[model samples]
Target: MAKANVKTVEKAVEKVVNLPAGEKIERDGGEVTALDAASIRLVMQGWEIRKKIDELDAQLKSINAQLIEAHGAGASLVVHGVCRASIAEREAVKITNAERLKAVLGFRFTDLVKTEIAYKPEAKLIEMAADGDEPMAPSIRECLTVGKSASVTWRAEK
Candidate 1:
């Protein structure tokens, strides 16, 4: 396959950016405003690039799975200058009948058991809290801490 000419795309983008606002350009047997054309082109190019990336990622995952199946976990091998593949085993605990175990063991198993507290306030609850209204749930009021954060969201106009 021939290599893509990245310079051509860059030049097209520069032309669109330099065009005055509300100026229209003629292309593809139709006239479109420079901003509109550029926006459409960017979204199309983004989708094409994302599709190619997803395809390559799926192929790589399949090859990795095959390697792991053939050699088993904790397998490592180098393939010349390309890359090295390694699979390692991980240990995890699976709990069954936590309440029954806790009941039978009583205080002796207290060290093995852990308690975690987290607070997720609802929009209405946040507003109520700001106005000094107590939370309906005591646990929520005990663990809740209000804070502010800044974030930005971007999406295609469609």
Candidate 2:
């Protein structure tokens, strides 16, 4: 039993290591290649759970699509001892381009849409700060601490 478990774990580790992107994770100073076993195990567990969820979600979506196709739009389905599923419709009012609408509407745009001044970081200034060189270096340092977070696109297929 222990041997089988160890082999299973080894295969999991091999699979993760064989992957191009997920092998080394980034740390404060640089990428860390040698991760602890517990950390790796936790990540593997999360991956396994997410894979199962993705499979279930795909199946649910396909089944829902079938139901919608069979019933057409704005319909419902009831399964005995189960539940009711809906393809109910609702109107969504969306202003995709508020700037264009404001330009075209002139004054009446205010009635429909509320506007506010939004301050956003400029990329060049951030780059200058990162490179430790610029006229805006002091200002960028004072005003902003530019940082990045992980962005994940799940690979559904192994």
Best-performing candidate as measured by lDDT: 2
TM-score of every model versus the real structure: 0.45, 0.46
lDDT of every predicted structure (CA atoms): 0.53, 0.56
The total of clashing pairs for model 1 equals 0
**Residue runs of model 2 more than 4 Å from their true location after superposition:** 1-26, 31-33, 96-100, 116-158
**Cα lDDT tens digits for candidate 2, 4-30:** 999999998887676544355577777
Which residue pairs show backbone clashes in model 1? none
